[model samples]
Structures are given as structure tokens and as C-alpha cells.
Target: MNLQAVLAINAIGIGIIVFVLSLLRRQRLHIGYGALWIGASVLGMLVVSAPPVFRLVTRVIPTSLPFQAVVVMALSFIFIVLIYFSVQLSALLRRVTDIAQHIGISELEAKSQAPERNPVEVEKRGE
Candidate 1:
């Protein structure tokens, strides 16, 4: 790799690592996701620092270019992560809906059991 490309890649990899660490420190990111981000950044750094790895990958994959292979790998990783998050979101939505239904049912049950009181009787009793 050229000096400029190496420098840029190192910068980006370091930046990603730093950003993920900060998010972890702030409790803004989950540990699982943060670890994945860190791993990706480290992988990027390794790929950029050593061009031979990319060459090996290209040879194995029969890709036209090393960059294309890298792009495909990155995209594939992103797609998998998106699918994982989608499933998690679906589960959370289902739980929330169940909780809401349970709350509604509880309110209805409570109302059914409680005797209705007349406002006029209450007022007269108060007076």
C-alpha cells in the first residue's frame, strides 16, 4: 500500500477504536456491540498494515481486486449485524406489546372488581 493509504487507514482504525472505547466508558454502547466494533477496527488496521493478507484473501476468493474483496467482507459483516439487530428489535417489540396487553387486562379486571360509588352520595356524606 501507498504511504497515503496506509496513513489514512491507520487514522480511521485508530479513530474507530477510540470512539468505541469512549462510548463504552460513557455506557452509551452495549459491551457486545462495542467489542464487535473494536474487532472490526483492529481487522481494518491489520488489513491495511499488511497488504499480503489482502493478496491471500483475493487469491482464495478469486476476486478481481483486493479492495473489492475487502468491500464485500465489510458489507457482509454489516448485513449480518443488521439482521441481528432486527431480530433483537422484533423480540423487544413483542415483549412490549405483551406487557401493554397485560396492563390493559389488569386495568379491566380491577375495574370489574371495584364497586362503583355515586359522586352525589360522596358529596352528601362529606357535607
Candidate 2:
């Protein structure tokens, strides 16, 4: 890659790292997610800044275009993030189901304890 292009990619990577850090500091981003983004950005910067790293990636990716390598890296990152979120979503869904089940059980128990009143009687009382 050209020096200018490498510099620009490095700058973008640095910007992403800084942005992720700021989000983490402000508690607007989850620590795990922030770390993931920071890690990816740092890796990107390393790949862009170092000739050896580029050579290694090129060997694996076999792409003449740096942009193509970047796109592959980005797609991999997206896939990883999607998997992580899917796991988190599955856990949350399980938790919500458990909570709802507990609530239902509690309501049933409460109803079993309380005296049964006729609906007509309750309506008359309301009137």
C-alpha cells in the first residue's frame, strides 16, 4: 500500500479506537463491545502500518487490492459481533422466560391462597 493510504487507514483506526474508548468511559457502550471494537481497530492499524503484516494477510487472502483485504477483515469482525450478540440475546430471552414463568407461578400461588369470590358479587360490590 502507498504511504498516504496507509496513513489514512491508520488514522481511521485510531479514530475508531478513541471513539470506542469514549463510549466506554461514558457508559454508553458495553465493556465487552468496546473492547471488541478497540481490538479490531488496533489490529487494523497494525495491518495497515506494517509491511510484514500486509504480506501475511496477502498470503492468506491472496488479494492484490488492500481494500479487498480490509473488506474481508471487516466482514469477519461483523460476523464475530453478530455471533456475540446472538448469544447475548439468547441468554436474555431465557432469562425473560424464566422470569415470566416465576411470575405466573407466584400469581397462581397467590390465587390459591385467596378466597374465591363470585364475579357477580364483585361486580355488585363495584356498582
TM-score of each: 0.76, 0.78
Tens digits of per-residue lDDT, candidate 2, 16-66, equal 988999999999999988888898888988887889988888778867786
State the lDDT of candidate 1 residue by residue for 5-123, as single tens digits: 77887898899999999999999999999999999889877876787886776676667766677678778888998999999999999999999999988997888865556879988
Full-model lDDT for every candidate: 0.84, 0.87
Supply the TM-score for candidate 1: 0.76
Which runs of model 2 end up more than 4 angstroms from their true locations? 111-127
Q: Report each candidate's C-alpha RMSD, comma-separated, in the order given.
A: 5.1, 4.2
Residue 61 of model 2 has an lDDT of 85
State in Å the error of residue 38, model 2.
0.6
Residue 77 accuracy (lDDT) in model 1: 81
